[model samples]
Target: MVRVTSMAMASLLSHITSLSLPLKPHLFLFSHSPKPTRTLSFSTPAISQNPDRNVPSSFNEDIGPYLSCSMPHNNRRLKVAVLLSGGVDSSVALRLLHAAGHSCTAFYLKIWFQEGFENFWSECPWEEDLNYAKAVCNQVDVPLEVVHLTDEYWENVVSYIIEQYRCGRTPNPDILCNTRIKFGVFIDAISSMEFDFVASGHYAKVVHPSGDQIHKDSALELSQDTVKDQTYFLSHLSQDQLKRLIFPLGCLSKDKVRKLAMEFDLPNKERKDSQGICFLGKIRFSDFIGRHIGEKEGVILEAETGDFLGKHRGFWFYTIGQRQGLRLPGGPWYVVEKDVKNNVVFVSRNYFSVDKRRRLFHVASLKWLQGLPPNQMSQLQCKVRHGPGFCNCTIIIEHGEDGNEDVAVVHLSEDDQGLAAGQFVAFYQGRTCLGSGVILESWDDQGFSVCAKALENARMEDKSLLGKPVKIKVKPETVATESCQLDGMVLSNQRPCKLST
Candidate 1:
């Protein structure tokens, strides 16, 4: 079976960064200064070295209870598929798993990136990343498989991202890519293989549904490495995906992982962490959006006095509460509203100028883990965006006119801002990531709407929700719920989903 290895500092460091600081997690306990390069050495562990390897003590003893050795692959080693992203985290992931005595194969999924836009922007690192992944596989003594998934990625994740921006909504493409591309489509391709599970370098944990309950509805939880936890991206994945997946580096800190790369002498050890979109290299978000949406010049007006702020790219390029890259003079401005029909963007110097703090919003296209979590309305923490962190909220289930569970009305227990349509809201109970939904509408005392066309056709979808209130009604009335089930387990027993005869 494969094992994980992280952190091999010759000596522990001199200082520690504050937890309050929003910086990437580091494993080296040293001063912020760079340390002298040290050569890392490790004796390769062959199958003959030790038939039953004792897990390293540094990985923590507590994991023993959660990841006990009594796995299904009792006599045989697990056939694990490791996703190599050509970064420090994934590179080290392969080493850790291979060392643990598991049979491993590495795969690099090539995705579609607008490489033609290289003249205006730098070219993406697809070729370079592939080479790095290959080198890592060689060093780890694992065979590598390269899968070309450009067409599938473009059709599902990329197209949806462009469409959302074109229609004037702030969409999280990473969430879609994780759910549809990595776990969803990728799983289909591996169906013919004899692989037992898939592994990635994501800093997240797959746990029993609830603490000490590993029955059926188990979900992914935040990693011990909170600074770089990636549970938010994997929020929409299904329980089946979680069942066949493992994050080898989930419990290790980033700095610890990096040090292991150096210790194992793995390729890409010094490779800088990937930034921005996974495949899209280093292009600015606005520049990337401008490429697809094209440039639709509009007037930027001050929300307070309707004073013209400046000429702006199409209102689609800006999201509510955006403060950077505004190019507007006389000061910093935050986007508050978008007039899609007239092609105008409203900005303000004050954050709460257009609306008061909002606590309630509506979410459509709700996809739950193992189906909707007990329909009883209750408090759960949620994150509107990947970076807004999380806030306490009470989620009420809403049903359509036909009595089928349709959407969710999330009432933020604390005041929050910048709620937008097309963005995902990831729900969480403590550290466990429950599920997510798309923002259909958000409201407050202010009369702004992110996707409602009634206010000015912000979301240019075919059906028009004219005259509909943006603020969802929270009366806590009875709402019909959808049935969620799988062949092996039933998500809920209360509502049985009708099968089409």
Candidate 2:
């Protein structure tokens, strides 16, 4: 084994940090790795090819007229606290707010990380973030505030994220950071700071209140930057958080924001956008996870026959639909199910087969943005992850005592591959994002979970259990199809609430 020093580690991190577009899309929403100067994160798409065109940065073509639908777009300069990640997006937001004559203060939130996991999960560069943040603040003559939320972040987001993964789920830390940290702890921190509203470079728009409804009740409109629109991450933000917050670069694209940073002569204009977990810096998912969960040896069995196909680093190291790192023989395989307690990974070559692909699943802890959306089952578009384009889905929810739908069963029009537990599902009607929920389980039953768990008693050292007879259980049949109401209803029901183009 080679000995690694902090100097060696720093150099490795610097090299790895420059690698943009991490393998994990959900965590790298804001890839703000530290550079010579600080950079702000707007969760923008890859830099556009053409940087010259200052595209119309509005919900629609007419921004002024659009805001006029509810409230005025312009108002007197107000003291705003901007969440600056020391990147181009947030930096530009800060400059714009400062230029517009709003009293601005840049805040950099710090989160928890493994003490010495350099090769995989990176250490948070709070010091460098602060330095570049200061550079921009000094240039604009604005004050910078760095709130160390390591304890709270670990307590609320980090622990929950790790726990979810350990329990065989792929949790999205970005969503949690928005709900529990950025909009949660940070919002409460500034409650007495006398700041009018907290702003960030997130590519999301806050639709001003409708009618006499002033601040807190305003709706969240999808940003004009559709490709980079982070309404998915911001979907869990409460109405009160929306009221006290502002997204400065809501209408601008990533490339356009970069251009503005250049035009403004911002100090950290060249700083690469951070490809990281909210504030946790860009890290290798497996390495970061293993640091907390530790690695355990497990068997990778064939999904259909329960044959001992191969071995995995750990069940926690793999996820549903993952094709890489199997290190097995012959051909590629996909993880179908994870037996967390038994430490077994179920894989199959037939990823698109009848027994594998799924179109429907159950989700617990359902939350509806703007109150409960249509109690009746309605057909709407939903995205499984942070990417453009959506699949048609019929929403099935069961209401709780408070008249809130605590449990939801999403019925997809077609089977989708790569569905993993613990991922966030966002509901959308065209450009307007409705809300999101956590995927509890899929309706899959191919002896994937049960067969894998019974391996020890079956004596699998010689791999005899590979072809053992196992009965497959289907979700609808096991959970009662009558309750899901999948029998007698039409799914072509579209909501009349189509958003403006």
Candidate 3:
């Protein structure tokens, strides 16, 4: 059996003390037999330094309860392939598994753009990421392998994203990246390696069946860190993928993970969390879209009045409910709809008006982890996007043209403004993830057809008023206060107004 010597423990304690960390004594205990059995127990409770954060009491629980099938047991040393992303979370994850007496092999996936796309690849920090991943693996004496999945990523994930955007739908690339690249192709690439499991720093728990429940399928659960839970992205994974996966940071919060990184003195301890799309690195989404889709001039029209507001690069550059980059005057404008055939974008100042109720939508291409939908379809919680928020929803099964139960009509208890086609809505029952489906359509309950008719009528009226004298009756005292010039067009703050044609 191998053990952490007293001197080693004293040195670790001294390091923690020098950092002024409020950690209690005897935080970790390991028991390694001929077949290496280990346990990680934390006596000190995890407390959030930020009181504004709403963390559950379970955050204080030790890591042992969440290990599930990831840890070695009954004198068995498991071989794990850990995915290191050169971030603090994965670095700490590698350290934990190595310390648990597992034979760990670290893999850094190289999926960045190719050489010809240097304009898009220039900002990618993949080289820096690989360096950090190598340093972390070297620190733990683990063999590191670089797996190049660029072709697979582009063919599967990148193409899907581009096609979805071109069709004027908002697709969640992260979700597709997980299902198609990370766990899908990456699993196939390592199939002959005989690794027992594939692990990542994903903040979600996997409950593999054991004991009397060995016949049941493995379940994915929400991590202790609600705000950082990544089940939304992994909800599209299949049962086979779920069974072969392990998440070491599932029970630990971001705060606790940072503390562990400090304790371990990892190479990427000070690295900030990566944001935006996984493959894009520091490149702007607009720039990438422009590079591929190549913008065309389009007109922006007001949904209610059909007034020519301004010009846009293209209709594909915007999504439903997008409020940024519109740059319209007279008020804050939001993207309400898009006319793809006409290359026209519709905007409105009162996007959240009382008439707009985005509570109903249709979801297709369903992927349930247990190979079946939940028995209680009438009640479920769903997330329209990846965040610490869930909406009380009910699912009504619908049959497709082939008479298969392939569509689900979801009705949210409250209205959501960000609902869009091609976005994956992750369903949940308490802590267990029930799986997810792609949104087929977001029902526009705001009388969009009526708005379109109004736009047509406004266009006809404008044609009639052309080349005719227009009279304006404005209160003399309020003219200076209420009227403003925007892009050589006069706009009034009062009602019943007309602009020069």
Best by TM-score: 3
Which one wins by TM-score: 1 or 2? 2
Per-residue lDDT of model 3, residues 252-323, tens digit only: 889988987776767688889987787777777788888889898776777776666677899888887676
How much lDDT does each candidate structure score?
0.61, 0.61, 0.68
lDDT of 3 at 494: 16
How does candidate 3 score on lDDT?
A: 0.68
TM-score of candidate 2 to 2 decimals: 0.74
Sorted by TM-score (best first), the order is: 3, 2, 1
Cα lDDT tens digits, model 1, 213-326, are 557565677776775778878887777777878887767778877777776666587888876666566566667778787996666666655554466778887777666667
C-alpha TM-score for every candidate: 0.73, 0.74, 0.77
Error of 3 at 94 (Å): 1.0
Q: After superposition, how far is residue 322 of candidate 3 from its true place, in Å?
A: 0.7
Task: For candidate 3, give the lDDT of residue 152.
Answer: 60
- Residue 227 local lDDT, model 2: 69
lDDT of 2 by residue, 207-316 (tens): 76643555435677677777677788887666666777777777777887787777777778898877646545555666677878998776776666666665667787
Give model 3's TM-score versus the native structure: 0.77
